[model samples]
Target: MIRIPTLRHVATRSLRCAARGAVQQRRWAQVHDVRFLTTQPSQAILEKYREKLSKKASQEGHGSIDDLKAAYSEKIQEQRKKDSTEGTPVSQPNAPSSFPPSKPAPKKASSSGEKPAIKPLGDILDLEKVAELPEKELTAIWRLRHASSPQTLCAVIPAPAYQAMESLARSNPYFVLPVPHESQGAEMHFMQWTFDPASKTSTVLFTQLAEYKARGEFAQPHTTVTHHLDLIKDKGLVLMQGQVMEGRNVQPDHAKWLVMCLQRFYGGWEQKGDELDGQRKERAEERQKLLEWFTNGDPRFSVEKLLEEAERMG
Candidate 1:
């Protein structure tokens, strides 16, 4: 029994020594592997790996989660302070509740037919109020409102009247001018039609006849003959009454009416002259026919006649 106990004690001591030796050998092998597996890793490699792990932790909302929560709390507190300073109500998020709630997806619009909206110029300009303004004010208003066509006479009148005048002015370019002295007391205001080189059209500007009389200039009635003669000499044609002025046999009534229309159409800026050519000569002939129509009320010499003449000229 004494031999047996001694042998067991020796065996236990040997086993413990072997186990310790094996553990030390394994640890030595692990250290060796780390030092020179293939090539020794540099200090930079270890540092890079550590940095990558830190970045991954941060992106996964683990490393900086506390920091982010603190930042958000600070932001909310700052917003509350701003709202308090501005005297505005600050909306707060509600705390999570146990009650169940239903959510619905947004609905799309129907693809069925739908008309677009329309807006008119009259609706754009309050015509009654505009008409009440003086000419200078009216011009300024037009300049402010429609800068593209600022000098146009349509700026001063009512919507319907302006439309009519615009329609008339489109076909003829007349200039706005004070009526000759001869028609100073006449009910109709007159403007001298002149050619505009820039626009290649005649234009006119008109206001109330009383407005001109109020200016207290040209107290005597002035003949339109000198005006027409000057226009013919300079521009070769006077655009008037929706007709080009050219040739002989221009009647006084027609001339007077043309001047009146011009005044009604323009605000008083004179235009340049038309380029004289064969086409102008034909236009002149047609103008003579319009004059004949104006004087005699002859249907034969009307616009249709002028159109026919234009066609023949073509």
Candidate 2:
């Protein structure tokens, strides 16, 4: 009843339990090793892994294993385009032999073969052949008495008197003995005066368009003024005094030059104009005296007596 087992029996039972545990562990180890080599993955498990990879690729954008093949193909096409654009020759191991090489086009010539030549003035004018020039030029040469038309004729004389003036004009200063042209005749003279010294006087002639065109010989002067220049007393004033003949003097340049010369000699002619004014006043006083004599002596025109008589009658 309640008796303990012996030592030998206990050792033998413990060894048996230990050996069964070792056998169970070896069986579990064999199952784990074989599963690694022979067991196939399930479809559901594969689907879960594929979903995880797709999620990872979507999170990282296009830089994924699935898109790598397309990216590589695009890179190859871009390289080919770059090479062609840069004019770099591309070497292919097996290239097509059907296409031919291109060549550059030749340059074209200008449409117009040559430019026109310019003519010299000598060729246009033909100076060697004077007769070949136009009729107008010939007429101008004949009328002007020179190659170009002249404007003024100047002659310095000894004094301002008319006798001295006439002598100088006849001898020189002008182109004398001009040959008359048929249909055109000769040009008329437009004359003026300029003085070199205040004492010395000169008769000047100018060419006007009308006078130059007129078909006649030179006529009498349009105007003749005997200007007295008193260099000593008046300094430089030209006295248009003594006898001033305002003939037909149409040329203003003649008069202007005369005035300018007078101003150069004398400061101004305002005092001369004043002297003329005194002469005019004296003449007016003489006229008043003549009118008074007629009114008083001849009773018919007495205005005061007529008015008094009329008032008395009224």
Give candidate 2's error at residue 192 in angstroms: 4.3
Candidate lDDT values, in order: 0.31, 0.29
Model 2: residues with Cα > 4 Å off, grouped in runs: 1-200, 203-208, 212-217, 232-236, 241-314
Cα distance off (Å), candidate 2, residue 147: 45
Model 2 TM-score, 2 decimals: 0.16
Q: Evaluate candidate 1 by giving its C-alpha RMSD to the native, one decimal.
A: 45.2
- Give candidate 1's error at residue 173 in angstroms: 16
Candidate 2: tens digits of C-alpha lDDT, residues 1-314: 11112322332333354456554322111111111111122334335566675666677675663563344454443332222122212222232232122222223222433211111112222233433434444333322321121222112112223333333333322211111112222212333333334223232333332332231122223323333332212222222311112334333343334323222112122222244477545543333332333323433432222222222212
Candidate 1 Cα lDDT to native = 0.31
Quickly count the clashes in candidate 2: 4
Q: Stretches of candidate 1 above 4 Å error?
A: 1-141, 146-275, 306-314
User: What TM-score against the true fold does each predicted structure earn?
Assistant: 0.18, 0.16
Error of 1 at 156 (Å): 12
